[model samples]
Target: MSLAELIDQPEFGHHESPRHQTRRVLLLGNDDRVLLAVARGLGRNGISVDVAWCDPDSPALKSQYVHAFHSVVPYSPHDDQWLDGLHRLVKQYDYDLVIPCNDYAVVPLQLEREKLDPDTHWYLINDDAFQVAFDKAKTSRVASELGINVPRECEITDADVRSGFSNREFSLPDRRSLRFPVYVKPRSSITASDVTNKRSAQRVDSPDALAEYLIHEFPHDGVLIQESFSGVGIGVEILAHQGKVLMQIQHQRLRETIDGGSTYRETIAELPELTEATRKLVQHLNYTGVGMFEFRYNRETGDWVFLEINARFWGSLPLAIAAKANFPFALYELLVKGQTNFHTNHTIGVRCRNLINDLRAFRHQKAEEFDLENLLFGKDYLDFYAPDDWRPQLATLVHFARSVLGKFTRRIGFSV
Candidate 1:
């Protein structure tokens, strides 16, 4: 039987008829691996998936699962063009659901929620909840109130901006109370409008370096000076509806890129303390849809410190799906069918790696010797290498090659 026919059968448990009813989803953001995984998952479940992205050559655009592709201006907090284009696409295609794949897309969509097609549903947290989750300072304060451990941080205020110290070199403050190697990052998540100098996070050894970074790197942006937490990164992903948790999974980071992004991770049993803290935080925020709570677990202290919450689909979504969490399908059922029937029990010890980024991580590690065979066989899953869908992987490789070539040409004072 055909795929549609199978989905329509009584045994398949889908309520919609393949001939008369088909759910449509419009996913925002294009370059992310999570976006491609979401499209493939929803498409296989009989949903007509459409894609919107800023780049014409994004990996998701090459996926066969995408029924249509629309080019929109990249996400920015002040851009109305993207919002207008999204509304037009929803009206044009009569999309049943709209899901933002990243924080850049989520913030604007939440801010302009009422301006879009009201009939169309969104897989997003409420505006108030989004505000709490988006700001790192606010998230830390709230999580701490719920008895969750969070790193101590000091917020840079307008007063600090006016102190003239922002322009002048300054010495370190008293080091008696503060720890060395504190981290400095934006108070809120980075948006597309931020320039290259405005990084997500930077580690500073002394107060002078912190002051220098605040002046040079993020002079205008609000920043948080947080104590550096030493530990392994753990992510607790939860899918919820109106404060009720539907599915949850936990993964431990095994390797990270030079920039501190996860490259290799494995599913693991949920830690009770971490799980309870996540539940309390999500429930307090009344968050809806999919969210991931990141933490730093110190093995010596047995402390799980809250990092921040991603209020949308995460980059490591494929690992969760591969381990049998099936977040994409659960989201579809929750939004379209008014109920979710997926199990949250995922297989532990299943490792997933983003092969390209893992290479970067490996280079950063600089081992004495390399073991090619062990590296190839150790990973249970790769983020973008499915046998059935080859085009996206090919597209990503081409994209990476072109990027490298462009950088090389620029360095050599030539243009191609």
Candidate 2:
């Protein structure tokens, strides 16, 4: 049987026949602002939600938007214990859907599909989904296969790590023809967070520098060397249903914590080509969830090469929600209503805000990153904690206070 089919089989002991029904959904990766926003969106739309994560300060735990909250060690979604936990939680609550808002959470959940409630459907892609999106080498290959534009690249392996940085016959010698100033990234075993701390990657201006990076910094294997694309980085958020894209929202980074790093200030954009390209790629993958496609514009090549695909909800979700393309609501509709008769027609303006308190390190490095005016008074997106409901609004304030106190204590001598 195919991987998607195998993973899609009902595991709750019975099936509900995919009917339009109000659902009790579980949201994972709790402390994430994106996940909190998703839960708020779903809750506002009347879908009951429960939250689980490792952090005590998970806003979902204290937020009025959630039905219940659980804190525990974040186990590998691939681990049987994780599956057991999921099964127990779903059985205990009789949840009908599981919505994961983080990439790490999605992969393991997809791997252990047999543990999910059969009555529950997951708003996620399958193992092949990870194969196509998260793994950079595989993503490039698959994009190339579909005639989708990707960087010309070569993979570096463990053998390359053992050998000194010499272009010998044992190595893929065909990379000799590639031009200088190529971008070298680890094929696997590294993440965005690694790039900030590790001196592994180098902007090699020549083959010697590439060899140097390989010898000293990038000693680990599973790397990729690709033609560097330098352009204004734009991200596209998409909601897809069984290979069809239902909504697309684009954003252009105004500023970020690190040069050529993740965004701290972004504005909604209108890019038809990006939207269409992301739509086509997801359709080919038969994606049935929320996803983001990150692309870097290469001024030299004048092409937008595919960078990565985030298979779950993305960071700038409130921006999309403000623009009327509500991903969380859409996922809820798919699981509960089965279809939404709604159409988005809102144009959310620019926004700039701090990353969630849990992302303290990022926010600390870039505390003054945002345009204060835009962050404080933007009419575009609603602040996650600034609820219109008085009760919930107070709860949000309390959550913020606790988060600040926790960070303050951590700053002193206490470990967070």
Candidate 3:
């Protein structure tokens, strides 16, 4: 019997034949803005969308768009329970499609893909494409090969770190090519087996700092150390089918924290150079899904460096919908309706802000980063609010209140 058969037997779910029903999709993720965005997008479009994640946030589960919420084991390459649960869920409910919302779901779906039903539709990329896209060093090399300018980067491979591990001596052999301040990032966002691998990239200034980071991180597979530049982060989002670009848009980060996507962003007209390079990159990957190619563009010099790619539905997905790009809807239509014609017209100068994250970002920003006029006027989208769907927003309020109250009480207790 195949590994898939052992993972999903008739005893688990196959025995019960699920009667065919309306198109339904299983979204694999935790409490992410993209999950809520995709859920609401698909649900409002007459497709039943269900939420499945490990240790789901309570407030996010209150979304009215969700048909059901299933908590399952988190995927670690060493474990089969999560995969088993997915197989059981798919077989029992007969999900028409499955979409991964974030890296946790994306990595697992790729590694354990064979254990799931091949005939069933899954929105994931091949391992080859994932390696090139997920690894910053590889991403830079590929971008350079395609005539796209990229920041100088060196990977601290296992070979580079073995001496450090064995004799406390480690350094990049070709470190002279890259300048400081340099940024260190795990080659892949997550490991196949390690659940606690979403370590943020760090900007290091000195050799001591780099060595300290290596001592602490112990990047087993490798870490990409790249030259850092001063510029704004720009996201070039695209939806492609079989390597053909369908539609694309670009957004500029207005207010951001160091580690994650911007809490405040505004859609702008696509830069021609970046868009052309992105098209080439997509065709090179033979990409079949919607993803964002991140870059940092310097206005002063008309220069840009390839950052990385989020090759799945990302944090700013709601912004895409607000701009009329509607990636989730496009994905569903592409697969379910066999529709390929997508109009690439997107409204520019639209801003999106996750109120909660924006509020936090505001606390950490300099005066220049905050935009007063755009905050008050222009096309804007608050990440978690819709007139029709007020329940999730309400849940967010409740959760926020509790969190504040808990923090205050803890402070008081400590003082007393």
Candidate 4:
């Protein structure tokens, strides 16, 4: 039966549709790991999947399940170059949905959802809500309003940003109260107009360094200075629609970089307090799609502090899928089929690793850093490698070789 015919039937997601007719999906703006994880799940489920990305060397391109590849700009503010390409893809082909992978694409899609047909299953949100989730300052406000526990924060005002710190002077009233060694993060990941990359929060150890850091990043709006917490990283992965949460999964870091993103993690059923906080935050935003409410948790005499939110799919997506959460398929069913086949419970203590990054982190352990021992060997559901889909294994090696060569050649003063 034709896809249109099959979809119109009452039992689309049911077992009746054999060789399920084309339900074309486009995965865009997600990083390599997330893209591969999502693509593999949906493709295996009889969806015709295409990948559109800005990076040529992305590992997702080598996935055996991908039907086709296209190059597209990640985001554009003043022009429709990126938007136009996306429009053509959806219009030319009756794509079931376009899943945005990261903030770079989510920001633009949220800003221009009307052009993309607001009624479609584009996995988008209104710009106002995006601000609350994407902007740290706004997230703090909303989290606090929801009575979710969040870290102590200090705001950087417009007047402070307007007064250039190049002269090494900017007014910070909270500086006296703030304990040294705090985190200074851009209010939003897309700090600059260009949206070049997902911005990183840095640790500034002292007042002079903090001033210098702000001076360097002067023009970007609303940089947040927050109290740093030393604790284990926790992620509450959730999927919601119109303020109703569908499914929630929890994972805690086994090994993580000093900044963010865990290289090695295992699904864990942690505190119920965090679960309550996550549900409140998602419902408060009336969040309309998949999101990860990231937190930092202290063991004793403290609880989960709302760190930030990933308004899209997260890097540890593979781990979630391995735990049988299957977020990609769940999201697809919710958007395309108009109903979610919920996985009532996700497996706990299922460890997953990004082998490459884990090894890199171990190789270059910094001074006074947590040692990574016996982590290099792991058979527990590798992130980039699948037993059936082994193409990424070769593609990843070639890409890594090129990256290392480029770095080495640059040291000798030449671009590879």
Best by TM-score: 3
What value does the lDDT take at residue 338 in candidate 3?
Answer: 84
- Residues 128-148, candidate 3, lDDT per residue (tens digit)? 788898777788788888888
lDDT of each: 0.74, 0.63, 0.77, 0.75
lDDT string, candidate 4, 191-227, tens digits: 4366666678888898789787776664457688887
Q: Given candidate 1, what's the lDDT at residue 264? A: 81
Write the residue-wise lDDT of candidate 2 on 232-264 in tens digits.
Answer: 778888777778877667776554443244444
lDDT of 4 at 148: 83
Per-candidate TM-scores read: 0.86, 0.74, 0.89, 0.86
Candidate 1: residue 402 Cα off by (Å):
4.1
Show where candidate 3 strays beyond 4 Å.
1-19, 164-177, 368-379
Indicate the residue-level lDDT of 385 in model 3: 70
Among all windows of ten consecutive residues in candidate 3, which has the lowest summed lDDT?
A: 7-16
Runs in model 4 deviating more than 4 A are 1-20, 117-120, 161-176, 366-378, 405-416
Q: Which candidate is the best by lDDT?
A: 3
Per-residue alpha-carbon lDDT of candidate 1 for residues 281-344, written as tens digits (9 for 90 to 100): 8889887789899999987889768888888899998888778788887888888788855666
Q: By TM-score, how accurate is candidate 4?
A: 0.86
Summing lDDT over every window of 10 consecutive residues in candidate 4, give the lowest-scoring window. 9-18
